[model samples]
Target: MEEEKISELKDKLEREKALLEEELSTVGERDIQNPDDWVAAPAEMDTSESDPSEQADAYEAYGENVGILHNLEIRYKNVRSALTRMEEGTYGVCSVCGELIEKERLEANPAADTCVAHKDEEV
Candidate 1:
């Protein structure tokens, strides 16, 4: 990829990284031991004062937040990885095959690690 195009994609990836981190913060916190890992924030509820039904509801909400956090964390990791690839001069290269990834695919997903031909392959 041209330096200018790579720079633009890097900017986009950085913006997405920040947005994902901000959104993750609302429902989770970065792990102390593992900066890349995120743990969902527990729902606020005074278990001692709340009824069993209320406690169950709180747990359910916590579970939902965990699910959301999991997805956001995955995206965050992908964005970070893409940024790293850019720094390493490997951006726009397909991870599954040693070939240049399609520009349109990259435009659609700047964090993509595979070309359209190998997109369905496991990274």
Candidate 2:
């Protein structure tokens, strides 16, 4: 990729990283021992003094947060990995095939680590 294009994508990735962190914070917190890991935040409601229905609601809310946090964590990690790849001079290469990733694919997902042909192969 051209230096200019790479720079543009770098900017996009950085912005996305910040956004992901913000979203992650809304429903989770980073693990103290593993900064890269995020755990879902427990629901804030105090159900101990409340009725059974309130306790159930708290549990349901926690479950929803877990699901949301899981998805956000994946995207956050991918964005971080993409930024690392950029620093290592391998930003636009497909991880699966070692080929230059499609420019459109990069534009569509600046955090992409695989070319179109190998996108499904990426974890």
Candidate 3:
């Protein structure tokens, strides 16, 4: 990719990375032991005086947060990985085929590490 286009994409990726981190913080917190990992936000409920039904609802919400966090964490990691690749001088290369990734694909997903041909395949 041209340096100018790469710069544009880099800007886009940085914006996305910040947005992902913001969203991740809303539904989860970074694990102190593993900075790269995120855990679901704990429900702030005082069970001592709360009704049984309220406690159950809190648990349900926690479960939903866990699911949402899992998805957000995946995207966050992908964005971070893309940024790392840019620094390593391999930003636009397909991980599986070692070919240049399509521009349109990169435009659609700045964090993409594989070409359309390898979209369904794992790297």
Candidate 4:
């Protein structure tokens, strides 16, 4: 990739990373042991109501947040990995076929790690 293109992608990736972090912070906290991990904030349960149904609702809400957090964590890690690859000079290569990834694909998603042909394969 040209240095200029790389710089532009770098800026875009950095901006995306910042936005992801901000969104994550609103719904979860970063894991202490693993920097790439994030956990949803525990929902506050108001026990003063003495209603078992309300407690169950809180748990369900918390469960949904956990699911959302897990998805965001995966996306965040992929973005971070892509940024690291950019620094390592392997940013635009397909992980499966070792071919040059399409510029359009990279423009669509800077965190993309594979070409369209190998997009379904494991990273």
TM-score of each: 0.96, 0.95, 0.95, 0.92
Better candidate number, 1 or 4, judged by lDDT: 1
The sequence of per-residue lDDT tens digits that candidate 1 reaches over residues 1-123 is: 888999999999999999999999999998999988899999999967869889999999999999999899889999999999999999899998879999999999999999999999935
How well is each residue in 9-78 modelled by candidate 2, as lDDT tens digits? Answer: 9999999989999999999999999998899999988745878888889899999999999999889999
**Over 4 Å off in model 4, which ranges?**
none
Could you tell me which 10 consecutive residues in candidate 1 have the lowest summed lDDT? 46-55
Give the local distance difference test score of model 2.
0.92
Output the worst ten-in-a-row residue range by lDDT, candidate 3: 43-52
What's every prediction's RMSD, in angstroms?
1.0, 1.1, 1.1, 1.3
How far out, in Å, is residue 51 in model 1? Answer: 0.6
lDDT of 1 at 32: 97
Candidate 4: C-alpha lDDT: 0.88
Candidates in order have lDDT scores of 0.93, 0.92, 0.91, 0.88
Q: Write the per-residue lDDT of candidate 4 for residues 1-123, one digit (tens) a residue.
A: 898998899899899989999888877898899877788988889978979899999999889888888887788888899899988998999998899999999999989999998888845
